[model samples]
Target: MAVLTVNDLCKTFGAGTARSNRVLDHISFDVRGQTFVSVVGPSGCGKSTLLNIISGVETHTSGDVSVTSDEGRPARLGYVFQDPRLLPWRTVRKNMLYVQDKDDDQARRRVSTYLDMVGLGQHGDFFPGQLSGGMQQRVGIARAFAVEPDLLIMDEPFSHLDAITARGLRAQLQDIWAQSRKTVVFVTHDVVEAVELSDRIIVLQPGGRIFEDIPIDLPRPRRQSDPAVATLQAEVLARLEKMKAITPQAATAV
Candidate 1:
């Protein structure tokens, strides 16, 4: 049931050179099917670098990275970046349909379904320019879900949004994920958000090595307002702070 696996992963910039920088070193992890995993780390912990390597946007120096489909077919992927990255000229529906394998009734239905799930059913005809930042991000989320990727990669999708907007989107994301149950790998520096959204969290330390792999045992459909949820969030944040104190080289942002 392993959808994605990274074995002894290593990535270096200008390897073997005098000024070479080793970003990721001997990283390893496995993302099982239909589970939500979050990677949280300091500024230079190679969080995004690991994600890029998984998405094939960047190459790893040495490692095994594999994504497999259940039916023995090619594994498909979906990505939601910090920015919406929608075409300015394309309408909402058109933007969602852009990454689809083809234009067909099933695909059209999927687009409509996810748009409605993100509460943007009525804005299909609207251009990206017409929507607010939060709305555009919702469209991006919907587009990724519409594709129904085997593995979904999210890179701080709410990092650019205002606090209130980010909170609302986080809730929406939880609801959609509850129903779809897509395997997700989310990268963020926000410990509270990571605790709320992830079933298991992988903490990357200063050198791209895993500091901790914690499991979240809370109930689903979690909300920040919930007392139990808030308590766990506080605990996770405190642990990260302790990690920061121990490793003074790591940047603290929780």
Candidate 2:
């Protein structure tokens, strides 16, 4: 079943004014349950704006958007932004616990499970200020997964970190996603990262149009150094160059 549906969606900053800007143009896609879909485009292609609309932070100018839970209930969403956004005063465990609907044992167990998946189980009691930037991002990722959201929205979660750290987190994310298989809509400017993490990559054009919807059919637990992974990443970059409007960020380092 489709967890998220967007039909002919469009978002314009100033709908009626002369300085109108339409970020997303007739965008349409269906994210089925358990699928990892990535929206990869150059800067100013409305990647983040599309995410904001999907998460209800911004309203669409036209068309329809819907999110549905598998069990006929209200849909739940979890978000991981570029910044970790953890409270400095709270412990890692408490920071995660604060977002839960209940403080029961089941909730605690789920929090612990996701923390362990991100390799932060031992540091749960530590405050965010005590951890490094990478660890804090892990907490954010763990917190998002702990909620068991029907759809996970990630907006360039690794963009702030150094290249080495970003690569490590990508590997950990893939491992964790392998086990959880939560539906994810990840937005990134990196073709290499998109090819590594996504089951399908949705390339957006300069004016927020869907340029290409490509399926990634490689095996799980892929690494950046793997021959096949590198090959696919190169091929995707090659095709994106044909667009001519692909931003300089397309060659973002792996």
Candidate 3:
């Protein structure tokens, strides 16, 4: 299992003087095992920064953050960004292999398995450019899971796709997550998407503080058409609206 802990975490883009901009402020939370957590907020609200800090792509100004695997080792991480981020010259299979610790047969098989999970089994030999935008994102998702990471970080992975494509990919992701059960921290502005995918939703207000940490008690394989899922999504969206109404800073920050 994977364990993640954050205590009084803070991040500032500039440390001193008049130009200093603090993005995250004393954020604290913990996630354990295979939970899927979504961080939702408006743009520039430090959603991506939080993920970057957790993934070590960015540094925090102060506070404690720890991620560990059940085996008492540093947890392996997987990340899927807004774009595919694939090398143009590489085949899908090669791109998947690029991040693997090993190129052995077992590792290769694992890569293939994940590709299949994302419905890209036969496209492994194709270059990223050969695929459509949605297909490329599918490859990105497949590549992330191929690594068998203890923690997976996704930053608006489906944001760039068309609505129909995004919906399809979301369903695919839910199916894959149900089977793989990887610990995931997904960042999104879409409350409906958050409700569908997360075991818990963490709402980040402007100025980088958490407004609410709401648990999603809904069942797996959630669909927008499902009444329970829709109800929860509406409730979350309503809360976000109310938050914006009450927090004058949140309105200005957006």
Candidate 4:
């Protein structure tokens, strides 16, 4: 099992200056093993910055943040960004192999397993340019899971694709997560996507404060077409709308 904790987190750019900007202000949350948590908010609400802080790509101005495996070891992390971010010169399989800590037979097998999971098994020999945009993103997802991270972080991994392609990839992602049961923290602006894919949804208001924390009690393998899923998504969206109404700054930011 893996655990992630964020306490009293604060991030400010150009702190203590006339032009300073504070993106996150005293945000905190905890996520346990096998839980799928989504952080959804409007633009400039620090969604991506929060992910960056958790992934160590950026530092927080003040707070305590930690990720640890069950045995008290540092948790292993994998990330899937908005874009594929693949190396154009490398083959798909070689790109998968790039981030792996080992080059042994077992590592190769793991890479192959994840590739097949994303329906990219037969295309591993191809280069990035040889695959469609969606296929390349699939390769990125496979590479993230191939490392078998204790905590997986995705920053709107499907937001760059066409609606049809995004829908397909979302389904594929749900299937893979159901099987692997990896602890995931996903960032997205889409309420429908959050309702369908998350165990809990955290809504961040402007200035990086939490407006609401919602639990999605629905079952797994949910579809956007399902009546129950649609109902929940609508309810969540309405709640977000209410948040915007209450916060004048948030409404302007959105």
TM-score of 1: 0.98
Clashes of each: 0, 0, 0, 0
TM-score of 4: 0.97
Off by over 4 Å in 1: 251-254
lDDT of residue 131 for candidate 3: 98
Instruction: Tell me the deviation in Å of residue 32 in model 4.
Output: 0.7
Q: Single out the weakest 10-residue window by summed lDDT for candidate 4.
A: 245-254
Tens digits of per-residue lDDT, candidate 1, 1-254, equal: 89999999998899999979888889888999999999998888999999999999998899899989898888899999999999999999999999999999999999999999999999999999999999999999999999999999999999999999999999999999999999999999988899999999999988778988999989988999999999998888788888888778774444
lDDT by residue (132-222, candidate 2, tens digit) is 9999999999999999999999999999999999999999999989999999999998999999999999998777899899999999889
lDDT head-to-head 1 vs 3, winner: 1
TM-score of 3: 0.97
| RMSD for each of the candidates | 1.0, 2.3, 1.3, 1.1
Q: Which residue pairs clash in candidate 4?
A: none
lDDT of 3 by residue, 81-181 (tens): 99999998999999999999999998899999999999999999999999999999999999999998989999999999999999999999999999999
Candidate 2 stretches greater than 4 Å from native = 245-254
Worst 10 residues of 1 by lDDT: 245-254
